[model samples]
Target: MKTPACRIFLFPAMVCFSIIFLLSCTGQKIVSLKTLLMGMTDRTGITQTPSPWYKLIQASSYDRKSDKVGGKGWFANDDYTQFSGVDSSKGRKEYILLDSDGPGAIVRWWMTFAGEGSYDGIIRVYIDNTETPVLQENALKLLSGQLLAGEPLSASVSPETDLKMRGHNLYFPIPFLKHCRVTIECDSIRITANSRKPSIYYNICYRQYEKGTKVVSFSKDELLQNAELIKSTNETLKSSGTISDNLNLYSSSEPISAKDSINVNIRSKNSAISKITLKLSAFDTEYALRSTVLKITFDGFQTVWIPVGDFFGTGYKKTTSSTWNSRVDDQLKMESYWMMPFKKSCSVWLINYGDQIVKADLNIESSKYKWRSNSMYFGASWHEYHQIMTAGAESEGGTGKHRDINFADIKGKGVYAGDAVAVFNTVEAWWGEGDEKIFVDGEPFPSSIGTGTEDYYGYAWSRPEIFSHPFIAQPSGSGNFHAGLTINMRYRSLDAIPFMSSISSNIELWHWLPAIINYSLTSYWYVIPPYEINIK
Candidate 1:
């Protein structure tokens, strides 16, 4: 089926119904499964501060002993087989993965297991302190599109990766009003530190809304009620190609010499750039891809500055890949669908810093936009750490010097949309065993901590295989366990982190071998003006 002229076309009806449904109850801030589903496709919704404000948090199987910064066990690598708590009161052992109270929703869930019978467990989700579970099924089957949702909504990564090593993910939001508890019941499961037999790893990203917010708790009947909407949402997410037909097209093909630049200006008020397409050719394609930079200014604010290849998720090489927001075809035609709204005018520039003259074709599509007070400007920042050395953790029998590498530090009110990392390893050992730590609103500790780098990118076990989903993708993984380049990225919709004041994102450079590597990071976000980024 062809996609709707506009995905947000369905947003109004769903949101109106949700408001009425909430009014029928307590007339409070309404948060229901329908609203959350609608939010999944509403790209503009993320730019504004979320109404009925909430905090995005994560529940993971990280080593519990790693509690303090620069403290003992801080770099511990026993990240598997850990649980929040275990329950054995009801005749069977139920290992608790996540337990939270009050109004909230589980935006994303990711899990991967090792050893025999690890995936045979029964996963159950209890809502609102219910004695019974709203969902009870085999953990792997329920998470990997065999139950509840399908395809992009619930899937395992990299069909090329071994089935047992793939990461299983579920993006379907699960909301609760009073409480929520997720557990797995498996007789073969063991809760020992660093246990390899039937080892289980998980990361659950959820939202905790403010008090007095009304939320319709998730139930099996809710899934049945919204089956058709769910199917439509899945279809909308999987839709590819151009975004809309009503956009004004602007194109240019010019050769950019060394130290020269080309600019495309859209002199319009109340407009948004809906899509951007570009292609480059040169004798040294890889060098051109790295040295040719793309910059954009929205309403006079320079909000984007990055190498074209990394910005398009191709890294420094032309690799074929696709995601919800970006794509690179077999012919190396790169495209981005990020909505960039501007007030008066916008400027896009391609700057060539390499010695070779690069031939370029750039196309941008803009549409009429109704910019409101809450509308924001899209921004991207990029940086690279060349030949950085890693100190292998004690688990690998080396000096434990694992530390956080800042991806982006923004001082402003905005939402963190997503990020991508490209790495060049110099050894044949695993290089991404580290986890992600995200701090928002000047929090003393990170609000969102992940299990591992690959896990944070919607995969597991550092499997060197290519995969693509609507929100996450690994275009190249040759460097995961060997000496080469690897690219991994994750985009957010409902899982987008909004910060009122500031946000800092970091990832640990915990390689298994004490070797030198090159790492580059590109971060995507949207913010109101008066913002400052530490990328330069």
Candidate 2:
């Protein structure tokens, strides 16, 4: 929600004092590497390092030239027409931006639509520069009594709001940011149903709004790291005798053409694989598989099998080439992440129940594990991500088996478990795409993090795959309003696609299955260029 800043002006006085921040390194500074990593990685403030950094800016209201065209949105609401609300919440529109106010930066932001709005929908944003005015605009909507699982029970402004349907939310124009703040204003709210679970939809966007300057929505270095994350994950899965969930493959015995798949038949009498899941190796990599699915014909019934999207919070989707859904066997319920490589791997799993899988096909594509924002988005030093990558519990989602992983427990942890660790001159998520990979020594970091659909990525954006941006995030601290429990203040995602129109169906439009493994963002980190900090 906030951005980091670099020291604005140079202070020669810092040179006289051995303030660690002032200098790169000492000739012989004595400090434990782990301790140094811990200290240096504490990104809990605005300008941890110094000037020439970036931050996120929110908006209250603003206007677009009736004749300008820079970016566009798909919400399909008239609310985005103008930035009004000069004073009254009647016509003014609000916008927000996530940028350094560089050239060509724009933002498209909206609030959580829970199908109930008796008043102005709430808008709370993370701000970097408090001095800047937050753009405020009055966006409005009418709610219709309706409900969607995982979404608010009410529906609106979709399929063209009318007497039969409703306008559920006031879609704000995308915000523009030079500096940031969030603006909220609405009136006359109504609710027809309860949102079964907290939706992860905090829809916002970042674009270059100014001329000549392309506000990097995300750190370029970080994006690269994210891209490389895929290869790192691929290697880990391959080494562990597992397959990357993004990879689609067929039995080595069969040849696969571009986007080709074979029939997997399950006969009534055959001993079909009721369930199959690939346990990811976590000792080396921290990628968690989500939204596991299956496709097969069992008992004369053929259908794509899909599980609840948050099944333990981890499953894969057709990221690149393969698209998958699940087929259910009421009598036999099996769920697993089986290996489906894109190319010729030696073998594959089979569920032989009178059904002959003429071909065991796999879908190989890039799906992402999206995290909201690391304490910041881009790349981090090996020192960063130590706590997040390690296991622990989310205040709201509960804790998991935080298996302390390192070289010490290598043997006991697993055979392929890595031996030694080192710093990589290269980062894991070197791609803006947010795909990053870790490195053990100079090789691919030998690790994987797997959560059953029941765990990690289970709660919408709360899952590690789609919106677990911790480097730029922190534990959602507690507030007096809600005691005994804490929600992650940093994690964010939009309510899954709202009814584009009344014509949209949950099954057909929203893909409401709680089992789609939305995304799995991976990045690599290594202990290189040793550095330390005094986190007071």
Q: Candidate 1 — worst ten consecutive residues by lDDT sum?
A: 2-11
lDDT of 2 at 246: 38
CA lDDT for candidate 1: 0.87
Steric clash pairs (candidate 1): none
- lDDT of candidate 2 over 1-536, digit per residue (tens): 23222112122333323433333353322221111122222212111111112122223111122111112321111112122221333364332222234322222233322333423343323233443233222222211221110112122322222322222222111222233344443343221233222211232333223242212222222223234443332233222112233332222234222233333322222122212332221121111122122333322222222222112122121111010112212212223222111111111222222212222223322111222122111111111122133112333232322222221110010011001011111111110101001111222221111111111111221112211221111112121112211111111111111010011000000111111111222211111112111110
After TM-score superposition, the amount by which residue 337's alpha carbon in candidate 2 deviates from its true location, in angstroms, is 19
Residues 1-536 of candidate 1: C-alpha lDDT, one tens digit per residue: 33122111112445545755667677565788888998888766765678888889999988877788667866677788788888888988999999999799999999999877887788888888878777877888779855778888999998887878899999999998899999988878865444545789999999999998888777655676689889998898997654564689899899999999999999988888888999999998889889999999998999999999999999998788888889999888999989899989999999999998999999999988888888899999999999998887566775778888989999999999999999999988899988898999999878888789999999989998899899999999999888999999999878899898999999989998888889999999999889889997
The candidate scoring highest on TM-score is 1
| Candidate 2 segments whose C-alpha is farther than 4 A from its true place | 1-110, 113-118, 121-182, 186-359, 362-536
Rate residue 174 of model 1 by lDDT: 92
Q: Whole-model Cα lDDT per candidate?
A: 0.87, 0.21
TM-score of each: 0.94, 0.24
